[model samples]
Target: MRRIVGADAVCALIAGALGYLVRFGPAGTDGQHVSLGVALALPLVWVAAMLVARSYEERFLWVGADEFRRVFFASALLLATVGTVSWAFKLDVARGFVVLALPLATLLTLGQRYAQRQWLHRRRRHGLFRQTTLLVGHRAGVESLHQQLEREAYHGYRVVGCALPGGRDVAAQFDGLPVLGDLDEVVDIVRGFEVDTVAVLPSPELDGPALRRLGWDLEDTRAELLLAPAVTEVAGPRVRIRPVAGLPLLHMERPELTGVRRLTKGAFDRTSAALGILFLAPVLLGIALAVKVTSHGPVFFRQERVGRDGRTFSMLKFRSMVVGADRMVDDLAEESDGNGVLFKKKDDPRVTRVGKVLRRYSLDELPQLINVVRGDMSLVGPRPPLQGEVERYGYDMHRRFLVKPGLTGLWQVSGRSDLSWDDSVRIDVRYVENWSLTFDFMILWKTAGAVLRGSGAY
Candidate 1:
């Protein structure tokens, strides 16, 4: 936290100096430039604004979009404050200065934060800077919690021991982690192992009184208490803890994916797609020509895909396969190594040399911009499913259809063709349940890296 704050202060100073230099170079011969005073004051004000906005809070740091969002809003608020102050004092504040400085500062701060997070993640991946967590619960719940924490190391939770309550004498290992002690001696185990956190999963043994007593016991130790609820894939924004009659009840708001928000999303998709087409017209034409010259099939591939509310739409893509590739499905069924529902072969023989390059970098999905403009798809959402795949969807999977299919989505950037059916469904459903413009922005931001890396792109 201290490092991040120091970096942010330095970035603010740099941004202010850069903005001043870019606008006015240096003070005039008569000392008429604004940079001298503004540059000196901007960094201090920027740091104050960030501290006041709680941008450096632990919960908002080094993960997800919350930190970025906070920084952006804080910067905007600072700009607003500057504008008001200038207006009220009738001072000459350069619009160019604010324009350049605010964005530059935000970008620099976010870059520094990302670099710091990468360094932290590298260490955490090797089991450094991570909290040594002691798991406490029934066997099944403890195991489930351990699996989740093990899968997501970025959370900085390293399970060092487990304490099962009222269980028989067990082996040394409990779900791969050591069984330190039973619930009766959780405090001793925590102190003995010098664990950082005692993560208590939902269990009958850890009642209100027991939890209160456990917290009291930990007052003298460095161990913090964390309760792991059973909720899965619910984002923090949706869940609120409300204490009703001394019982903490989890209140979740229903996701609003309709009305004005939906209309705004549609407008954004069409506008962005239209502008993208206008800008990328030449590249699109060049790709079309390349596909035409390289393959015997048509340049554009149009196929039926399930859209919002079970509507079928003609999804478009650049043809990356032969004319009768649909018919080739039967022959490739024996070699099918997809996630069961979707048919994807990372090294299918059907791909031509040019098609392979196009798919590798996801250039083939460019034509789906037309789908976005035509209202058949969004710029971001769940991946459009084929009719066959839709038929295989269970009740929970149908939730994806509440919004329009997207040209790019969580499934696309997460693992693409490499993701399992369950994983794909999990990501898509999470997006559907937690749809927001900011979430869309984050996905779009991540899509750039995913495309460049091409890890899971076929």
Candidate 2:
């Protein structure tokens, strides 16, 4: 926390000096003296605003978008305060100074925070600076929560032990973590284990009153209590707590499918797709030439894929397999290396020599930008499934069709062909349930690294 404060202070000072230098040049003018005074005072005011906004709170630090949101709020608050004071006092505050200083400070501070977060994540990956956690719930819920925390180690949770509904009789150990005690002994267990976090998963025994009492019991301890609700895969923006008649209710907004947001998404997809195609014209042509020269078939491959609402579209790709490769599916079915729903062979006989190179760097999928331009796909969405694959879909999997299939999506960025069928479906459905422009942008950003690594491509 002190490191963050110090870094923020340095960023603010740098931004203030930079703004003053840019707005008022090095000259001994009347405005120069006032500008220097303002520049000197900016860092103190900026840090104060951050304190007022609670940007330094431990819960908001080291993870999630809340920290960035608070930083933005603090910057806005500072601007609003300055604007009001200038207007009320009729002081000659330079608009250029305020404009240059506050925005620069915010950007610098955000950059510093990002750098620090990256450093912290690197340390956490090696099992450093993590919170010792104790799980309290039924075995099933505890196991589920434990797995999730393990998967996302950067969140800084290290599950040391658990307290189940029943003590040792239920089970001596769970997934290798010692079963500390029963729910009744959680407070003692937390203190004894020096737990930094106590994660209480949904359980019948821990009702409202019991949970409240547990909270009161842990008040003197250093452990922070976290409740894991049954609801899963919902993003923060869609969920809100509403206190109605002294009872807190979780309110979830409906997914944005048909509205101005959808319209904006469509426009962005087409426009960006068009620009991408234009920018990558040379690379596309080069790949087409290579495919044509190395293979006995056409340079382009078009396959029927299920899109939004189960509508089928001809998804385009640079040919990465031999001609009539589809006819050999049954012959290679037994040798398939794919998750049951998707057929992927790491070393398939159908893939041409040039095709391997193309698939390795995901060059084969470049033509899907045209699909985006045609409104048959999005730049970021669920994977486009084959007609046969759609036929085998369960009812829950159909939720993925709520939006157009994407050129790249959670499946693509996560592991592409290497992901299990269930994982792929879950990721796609989760994305559909929490669709937002910001989420799309984040997926798009991750896509570049995924493509470069080429870890999961067949």
Candidate 3:
């Protein structure tokens, strides 16, 4: 919710500035028909579209490309809506002005957002612009919470230390963060450190009355209290808070993969895949030729992978390893640095020279676009697990097969093979839980940057 408010403000400012530029390039600035009326109308259109499209809603800010997609979709709707109204009302609307305004507005808004994220990240690295946090939880919970906060510098939180309830040992330091004091000193901890946020990580023996009282005490102070659940990789949208009889009940919505949603997703996948194949046809051909000429094997690698509902599909890719690479699995396992379930090597002897280039820029995954068109895959989804990995699945791991696997996903944009199998499953499950078209686009956008950087590809 906070992210949406921040983003909406940024979008409004950028859109308004662009509208000005469109209305009066220079002469209007010289006080000739400034068109303040048109400028005002433009923001109204954008804001209305934003609201209608739910672009400024809370569900999308932290994840993949949903925010940007909503911006795009809303901007288009704004232009179309106002354009229609102008014709009906016989208002003097300039097509040239709107054409110039919309794209510029979107570009500037997204650019500024990226800049702000960079600035915020830098501030967090130095422990500046950080909210002073009083960690309230058990030792292990506090340690995990602290590390997570540290890893995501963009979150902009400074852990002053922890105040655990009924905590043992009452250590002076925990994972380099000081254990300020015990539970009874919660109020003092808040005051002494000037803490602005109290993050309560879940504890098995957490006192319900004490927690309630802690909230009461915090109401007097200007501190924001946050309860960090044991849930990992679960997105905000899946959780809903309802006040029933004064008890704040938290409900987690189950994953849905049927009816209109399934159809909508299928349409999205096919259309995107078709367009992608058309767009990258030339590049695909060139890469295929290069691989065929450079290597003494098949141009493509057709491997059976687990897909939606544990269905088996031959996922396609430009062959990166030697012919019969499957036979040497045990040999390579000896050299694997990948998470236990998956097989990966940063530098493998089997990779041909052309394969190296293909893998770096992610050209190897081009064939998956065909799979997308065939309804065997999606443009954005959880990374497809190999058949063997699927066979080894535990109860939680089964969630990864709830949706069709994708060419790019949270797992890809995140550290890729660098991430542990446990972490990969968690991210994949999160995506499944909060699946959306906008999210797919976000992951697709980030995939381009990831491919460009070639970070953790192997």
TM-score of each: 0.88, 0.95, 0.80
Error of 1 at 2 (Å): 3.2
Worst 10 residues of 3 by lDDT: 26-35
Error of 2 at 322 (Å): 2.1
- Tell me, by lDDT, which candidate is best: 2
Tens digits of per-residue lDDT for model 1 on 90-193?
A: 77768887899889999999899889988998888788888889989988888877877876787799888899865337757877877877888999988788
Candidate 2's displacement at residue 320, Å, is 1.6
Checking candidate 3 for backbone clashes, the offending pairs are 65-442
* 2 versus 3: better TM-score goes to: 2
Local error of candidate 2 at residue 333 (angstroms):
3.3
True lDDT of residue 309, candidate 3: 86
Clashing pairs in 1: none
lDDT of 2 by residue, 219-291 (tens): 9999999998788888888999999899998988898888999999999999999999999999999999999
User: Best to worst by TM-score, what's the order?
Assistant: 2, 1, 3
**Over all chains combined, what TM-score does candidate 1 have?**
0.88
After superposing candidate 2, which stretches have Cα over 4 Å from the reference? 90-92
